[model samples]
Target: MAELQMLLEEEIPAGRSALLDSFTNLERVAEYCESNYVQSPDKHRALEETKNYTTQSLASVAYLINTLANNVLQMLDIQASHTSLLLFL
Candidate 1:
């Protein structure tokens, strides 16, 4: 839901806190999936809830991927800088 996303966006900070929050969000989705697969009082409501949870899960994954990409780029830049120095010798 929009509200859940808003809460997630506002409360969770970047870095370790964000990563832990993302894991918690993923756990919520997994728990929901486990419950919904059996039976539910309102199928539509459960489906909608699961959809929202899935969105949060995807956001977490995207954030992790972006973090990794940034680190990799930084490492490559450092390596390139060193290479240019080495070439001078």
Candidate 2:
């Protein structure tokens, strides 16, 4: 568990940095959001308001992962269906 945690911590920072590095607008927003997030409850509302920044950042990453997963599943289903069709033929 500790090893997994350690590995994840390292990987997450790299991934976060990569995500942040992707966009100029998002980077600025994320920087402000991050800074505000640490300050106090007052700034927390800003983070809430900047939903697009956070959502876009995550969506870019999540979309690709989801798309790849969906593609793989679809390919597997097609292959299975093809096999069945071959058997019928």
Candidate 3:
């Protein structure tokens, strides 16, 4: 349990940083695509595809972060219950 906690503590921040970086990159790409679209309307389909791919990537990263958070919360709840039971004993 302690090891799990330690691992989560180490990983959660890294996962968060990754998620933030993905968002930052998506924003930059969207801005670039927007500017380029204005200059070349023919690239609209490619820009749309890029937007779709980035949106999917963001969703996947967000889901991973959410799952990690839920796991951490569940671990904390189990730890709390165990501690309470130990005190009661």
Candidate 4:
């Protein structure tokens, strides 16, 4: 259980770093496209869709991570209380 918690704690930061890196890359790509060429209506629509999808996917992943962290903390809290009770008796 301690190992699992530690792994998750390590993973949460890595996940956040990945999300930031992805967004940074996306921004660079957008800036490059804007400076280099004119996009057609279809291409612009496609870009918008892609951006929306990426945003939603990132949100979902973040939500999942938050939920997992909360669950782990709750489990640890319960276990800690149980251990304390056992020690008390």
Candidate 5:
């Protein structure tokens, strides 16, 4: 039980860090697109690339959120089961 608790503690923070990193990347991409829009010789290509990167970043953030939610749910389930066992004992 302690080990499971430790794992959840570690995983939840890692998931959050990953989510933060994805958001940072998305912001950086947007900044880059805006900064280069006036200077980019190939505007269409740059826009396409930015769109693709933004899409991927959004997907990554979504997946991380789902993972973190699942982790929390699993932790809650474990605690509930432990409580039930204690009550029965």
Candidate 6:
């Protein structure tokens, strides 16, 4: 459990940074594509859809991470209280 927690703590920030970097690169490419590669209305619409999908995916991941962290904390709190109650008894 300690190892798993430690790994999550260590990796999450790195993962977030990587995700940010990727998103930045993606935006730059998308902008360039819209300005240069997207010559048709259909292509422009496709690019917009891609951008929206990626944004939604990232938001979902962030929400899930927040939910997971809260659940883990709640579980730990419950366990600690149980332990204390047992000790008192």
True-structure lDDT of candidate 1: 0.68
lDDT of each: 0.68, 0.63, 0.75, 0.66, 0.82, 0.64
Residue-level lDDT tens digits of model 2 in 3-89: 345434654455556545666656676788777778757765766766756887778867645554554565566667768999999
TM-score, every prediction: 0.63, 0.38, 0.64, 0.53, 0.83, 0.47
Residue 57, candidate 5: alpha-carbon lDDT: 74
Please tell me which model should have the higher TM-score, number 3 or number 4.
3
The numbered model that scores best in lDDT is 5
Q: Which structure is stronger by lDDT: 2 or 5?
A: 5
Candidate 5 per-residue C-alpha lDDT over 1-89 given as tens digits, one digit per residue, 9 for 90 to 100? 98567647798788888888887887887888787776789999888877887788778888989998988788888888999999999
Q: TM-score for model 1?
A: 0.63
Instruction: Answer with 1 or 5, whichever has the higher lDDT.
Output: 5
Per-residue CA lDDT of candidate 3, range 1-89, in tens?
77567646876666677777877877777787677777776786867867787778778777878867876787678788889999999
Tens-place lDDT per residue, model 6, 20-82, is 676676676667656654565687677777678668767866765675566556557766777
lDDT of 1 by residue, 1-89 (tens): 44334334543234446677777878877887769955888888878878877887798788776775565565566667778989999
Worst 10 residues of 2 by lDDT: 1-10
* Candidate 6's TM-score: 0.47
Worst 10 residues of 4 by lDDT: 32-41
Across 45-66, the per-residue lDDT of candidate 4 in tens digits comes to 6667667766766786677668
Q: In candidate 3, which residue pairs get closer than 3 Å at backbone N, Cα or C atoms, i.e. clash?
A: none
